[model samples]
Target: MGLRAKKFTPEVLLSAPRRSEGIPNSDASKVLYSVSTYSFDDHAKASEIRLLDSKSQESSLVTDKNGSSEPQWLDDDTVLLLHGDEGGVTHIKVGPVQHFGDGSYIAGTIDGPVGNVKLVRIGNGTYGVALTGKVKPCGDLYNPEKAEKPVTTGREFDSLFVRHWDHYTTENRNAIFLATLYKEADKYKLSELKNALKGSKLESPIDPFGGTDNFDISTHGLVFTAKDPDLNPATHTKTNIYLSASKNFWLDIAKGLPEFFEVPISNFEGASTSPVWDKTGTSIAFLSMKTDGYESDKNQLFVIPDYVTPGWVIHHFPGGSSGQGTWDRSPQSIAWGGNDTLYLTAEAKGRMNLFTAAARPTGLNPVPSQLVKGGYITSVKVLNSGDIFLTSTSLIESSLYSTVPADHAKRTLSGQSYYTLPVDESPYDPKSSQLITKYVSSSTHCGGMFGIYGHQVSEISWPGAADDTDIHAFVIKPSNFKEGKTYPLAYLIHGGPQGAWGDSWSTRWNPVLFAEQGYVVITPNPTGSTGYGQKFVDAIQNQWGGLPYEDLVLGFDYIQKNLPYVDTDHAVALGASYGGYMMNWIQGHDLGRKFKALVTHDGVFSMTSQLASEELYFPFHDLGGTLWNNSESWSKWDPSRFAGNWATPHLIVHSELDYRLTMNEGLSAFNVLQTKGVHSKLLYFPDENHWVLKPENSLKWHEVVFDWINEHAGLEKYTVWRAGNVKKQPEDS
Candidate 1:
């Protein structure tokens, strides 16, 4: 059979980090607190650890490494440390240090396979350890028989058993307490322990304005930082420190102890809390949003003194007030540092850096200073001997370092031995960029059916490509593509009218995956893509289907003339969301008979209806005003006006739970297609949301769309050619 006449099977487009999930963290500081480089050689991998000192400086390693180590101060001469394995298991060890980087130390392993652990002083000469682990009825602390042992005294205690415990206080010992989620406040005594622990059950705290919540907690009062709502798929409100403590420690408060502070509704409304107590325990410092309309920045510092009015006195930091900076600066880690001085780790110069501040009066602002520049610093610990321990990271590696606060000289401690991993190179390298090309070929084409690895071709460019323009095209000659044969081209549109179709990784919208299905896919970032600049982004504002649409059409024409093998008669218009909106709009206005099929996914049909029913007013604000205010512009570009003219066969795929665009928008377009008797079908996912987050539903969505395109375009018979294998034809035969 001729190359163009062979029956081809479509290829499945798979996402890289395929079986291996992408590391869940966006910033390196969040994953590896402190980094220290050991060697500068090409072959020698560097090592690093999260340490206790803030001023310690180190270099990057040249080799590959694994896991992490965090150091904590046991005393002036000794330290308690955690060594983590590749499997995420952490081992506790106690060690002695000589100098900052003396390369000298003796250490002893204390506990193995421990989960999360925090140190607490229980009593005079005694300490209480709180951790997160499985609870067993009665198991030996050392030498467990099972591969997985149940925890008896950690965060998992409540899951194993439920019991009410009384609150009590001892003279000098620190106390550790645990409880189930069922217990209420007024049960735990807070005054008896050297330090108190509280736990919260809310996954995320709900806002007073009725937005989604974002908090989660274990049995103890340690507050885990809540992630950005946009970044995390899970959305719950994280409780304020007072509420979290009241929920878990209220049951254990002693009868004679001071009354628990009542958390004001204003504090919980639109802000989160990070509570840090002074060593004297008479004062507390917290981070909160100043919602009083005076301060627009979401991060501010507040202090509460027991002797004062018992309410918090708010103070705005340098970057805490609105218009002071462009980035959001939250105090991640804070230390007392004695002499009323406070050391904090925060994002300063586009990266995480260390800063110091001194406490003034309750209502007075503290003087701030930048202690360290660049790199991300985690936790800072000040020892009685006037030395500091900290965990920090450079662009390449993370490690533990200590320095005398007086001179600021720093040195590496442990975890300095394994800086040999290649993956620990310059932390600033564009890791996401490398994954994009792999994802494009693995999944984008063939309805995500097959995977193809290791294929190289030439760069296809446009006549006016610029330095700022990263536009590259690929051509896959059909496996059965005869010497004189031609095939239909599918100009696939990417969503994120603001998003770019670059050499970046995407779990969806794969081109190779589409190519495997026997259709040539052409995708271009018309404008408003990120990476480009402010002008490109602002170009699409209120001009959705204008110049950007022109760019797509121009690119299409360029490809058609450059690649004559494509059959213009069988061309199709396919896209989802914004892309869907473009397809619906163009089909009505443009006289393009080359495209025989149109597949729209959750597209916007009527801007008027959309502007009226959208959950928020921002979309309208972004449009420069309400539809009534911009009727002339809205009417000239609205897709609904063109719906009456659409004649191309189309398939509409929408999810009912898509609040962003909503299901009504898709129905509006479907109604138009139905009235015109245009070959059309509406596929609805009742439980699915905007992105088809579910694995099974996503697979089904892809299958149905490809089936419709193949059936309408008459490419179903050549399924094998859709699998990514093609015959190379002569340049000019």
Candidate 2:
């Protein structure tokens, strides 16, 4: 029956850091670094930040109540901190260089009217601070506590501008120079900050034909990282480097921009990130790739001398790729322990650990210094005493650990180094794991919501349940959920008809906001979800709307019968991309009368039209072959095949720049719903691409979705949770 729900055993979910880099070093053999974790509380919540000491094993928390991140150490005792709140605040805080337990930390606020501050140290004790805020007349310092007039009003700061300032140069004074946005405006305007920070400002000379990629500033000069799209074997897939500096201090001798260095193609590739220069500023060390970007491998160390002429020479260490092809062995948190020694935090065989490399431009001799099993090494930093501090996390909590060099052997710090930073570790279910388990579990609700979190079900056993066809489902219950009370359920379908729902934080398609709004949100990976092995993924090769439709129906049936607390009659089916395809499919197929409304986000309706369009060629490739070759299969599964039967009220959402699915898909779906006289609405974002990434746009998106749900389902009333204008609903014609 309906492909027997394909018995699938889900694989273990692998979690790793998305971004990691060593912080700017304050002194010789002393460097600070930071790491981030997906928040268990809310997806919108800012990542946790901790300060690590490399010399004397110790770590400390840097963020406060609202959330702190992007920490840049200004000096040994002072750090520039940025808080991720509605009004992003940037200021300098004076704190202890080394972390001590007992919850004792001394921090002094540096008063300024800057809204979002991005700080970069240009020279010794001299820093560049970028200020962005709403324009208003300069009056009393725009302190949150004592501002009489609206200081940040008028046009908001959409640009980033850099100004030279010094932290240790003045005890309590901050000397800020507001610069003009390059080319856009002249005469020392403060708004020009954004343009100067773009990759184009620090242009790359490596491939004059290669467009600007990414760039950063270092002590030696500005390093611009780029990729050549036309290169053989896809150049710069993982390794990245900087061009050599020129004789003139203002220009780089490596070619391209006068102020930037171009990285040689031979030395760069394989997902390279976080490039830093040595204390001597004569050589640069960066994470090098041993395999393709998608492969799970520990990035090896690659060194290049800054003085190498014409082209830079690359060196790989012996046994350097020891952990290659393994997810748990990637090296992170790299810093210079000394001019000759490089320290890094790594994970191997599912254990978080540390390693040291005595490097030379010719070759690297790496040695395994420490092994931290059973926990994750999130960050590492070196101290003046040659001690190493690290921030670590387990499933239960995050803590700080320290180690010091003793008799030439590194040892954990005694009672003096370990510090337990205060963190809200309230148990929030891991949505990714739940989803995985549910997909593999045998239950009668073959596809219904079963887990405690999105797309995961803990118990798949249902009354009178038989056969392995039962698909388990997971739903994220609201934070302050009541035991027996019913809540509106939002049935979410993931894109990639091939993609499965898992427990991970998505900056886009955030389900936490719905849970926070007192709604039960459900996501079912269905068949063809990745991470469950190759067979399951291959199941949906050309069966997009066939067996998958039945799985969803069975899931709905199970949820309605078992989850009485989930107002099944008031549920809304929502999805984007491929998920949107399912929504239209369900509407046309008349799968169930349970859902009161639906939302289709940039989904394909007419597969025939989509295949003919030039915009959808890549997606066609991902689906196995072109529609021309599989015309019968494509037509059979096309949502437009059953469009004439669609009667469910729906809301269509899409972005103008979404070339993948294109706005035409949403527009066509909306037009069909309107012609059929079905109750429907449309929301179009002009500036956003496939996903709404802007902060303001994200807020508006949430507001609009909630408003649409409330209008049709009679859910909770809307209210502004944070400061910002709430977007008004477009008038229904």
Q: Pick the candidate with the highest lDDT.
A: 2
Candidate 1 residue-wise lDDT, 1-733, digit = tens: 1112122222122111121111111111111233333221232333444322212322222112254344444444444445555443444444443332333222322232433344444334333343332222232122233345546634422121121111111111111222121112412111222122223122212221211112122222233223223321111222343423332232333322223343442443334555555554445566654332111123455555442344555454543234222223455556666546666666532245555666553344434555654334444656554344444432212222323242331211111111111122222222344211001010112111122221311236453222354333444443334566666777777676655454322345655456656676666566554333334544666777776676666677787787777776688878887788888877886734557889888777877765433232333433655577777776777888877788988899988777667788888888888999998999899887666745456556667777788776778733333344334321121
TM-score of each model, in listed order: 0.46, 0.50
The Cα local distance difference test for each model comes to 0.46, 0.49
Predicted structure 2: lDDT: 0.49
Q: Candidate 1: deviation at residue 323, Å?
A: 11
How far residue 374's Cα lies from its native spot in candidate 1, in Å, is 24
Q: What is the lDDT of residue 258 in candidate 1?
A: 28
lDDT by residue for model 2 (1-733), tens: 1121111101001011222334534442333444543332254434445554544525456553444545566566555554433433343333443542223232323343443343444443344344433222232123444435557644433321111111011111211122211111211112212222132322222221221122333444444343333332111143345443444322221223343344553533454544555655566666655434322223555666654352564544434233332222346556666566666666432234555655553333333344333335555556555544454433222232333242122322111221221122222222322111001111111221111222222223222122243344446766557888998888888887656554333445755446655677776666655533333444676777866777787777777887887888788888888898889999998673568888888788888666433234233433445677867777778888788888888989988766556678888999999999998989899877667765556655666776677566667544432223222321121
For candidate 1, the clash count comes to: 128
